[model samples]
Target: MAGLKIFGSDPENQPKPRQRFADDVVGRFRAGHTIDDRPASLDEWRITTGDPDVAARVYELFGGEEPQEGAAKGEDNIEVFTAADSVAIIIESAKSLRQRMVLWGRSGKPIYVSDGEFILDENGHPTEERDPDADLTFQERKEKKDIGAVPDIDLFFRLADDPDLGIFLFKTGSWGLAYELARDDVQGALEQAEGPVKAVLALEPVSFKAKSGPRKGQTVSYTKSSLTLKGAA
Candidate 1:
């Protein structure tokens, strides 16, 4: 019931298309009831979905429109996003992002991402297939003709006060270690969140300062706040 559970959309056309990559990030958004950045205020977690095939589901959730610039009226072009409009729409809307487990993928043409639905049990119940190491398992997704595993899901956002930074990303550190403890906390927190929640955040570099090898002295990103919501007290 915890550790980064993302719900995908299926009812109809919705939220993608601009071609975003892991390194494209500039900043992040946090879940806060107000425009504050301190840690105690931040609550909800902005992490990626646990589904490996989350890539395909992403396109399904937020589909872009086909170009209609040169076409005749009512040409029915696939309503696409020339930019990161869906993220903008969600932020501007009064809807709770919790409605669908959001996992950001790309901004351009939707490509092939593996179907990560859970394999069923003998009695047709979902098996224990969804559990993948939060810091190790990678999605079987890729951009068109692009090599390597899919980049982790990230969000497009900018500080409400620092508009100078433009739109950046609150990248769900899919393979990073520092977020291990936080991911589960996030999974549990999101489950309890409700209503139209929104907020601004200040990213802080945090360290657990592991006393041993490998990760000793390593630094990972940490968002310092969460938005306002019922029961998030």
Candidate 2:
């Protein structure tokens, strides 16, 4: 498989939050093996599946404390992520692509997103359906909330601890499962594992510069580097 060039704003202009996330993602992409970013055509097919609800699964698998303020009283808190540690991911898509798949009616193409085991309603009632894109009523958001959607520090370690779904970078193209990079090695403090497992990632689109002035097209690509697994720290 060939690699795709990742384009982004100037590093200097990127906020700390974005830069930190991007560096972490790029570092993982470069870990354990020499990887290259080559130019290729954009993949028409794509899949995304990291729901906030499933965030708790990460904390449960790893070790971390949840936020104190929002957590229900007397409930044991799990450490995951906080407003102080939130990260953002930005992906590139042509208007055509976005409209065709992500938007409604244009083609009604299916977009893959996360669907956890449960859902919540106002007053903390459990619900049967888990609709990722269902419009949330004001009451639903005000009272009904999913504890699992929130992130915690524990999620990092869980990825490292769990064998089934460890820290990884998963990419899919037209057919399916294009590439997956799971980092099991923790190198000193730079990549230390605080718990039994750890996983973090930043995902985005690959970008490139056009060669010619007019009408010349650019390309995107995806490639698998190497997979490494070090023991718990």
CA lDDT, every model vs. true structure: 0.32, 0.28
User: What lDDT, from 0 to 1, does candidate 1 have?
Assistant: 0.32
Range of the 10 consecutive residues with the lowest summed lDDT in candidate 2: 92-101
Best by lDDT: 1
TM-score of each: 0.27, 0.19
On the 0 to 100 scale, the lDDT of residue 163 in model 2 is 32
lDDT of 2 by residue, 108-134 (tens): 432322222334444334477554534
Candidate 2 residues lying further than 4 Å off, grouped into runs, are 1-113, 116-127, 131-222, 225-227
Clashes of 1: 25
The alpha-carbon lDDT assigned to residue 152 of candidate 1 equals 34
Alpha-carbon shift of residue 145 in model 1 (angstroms) = 24
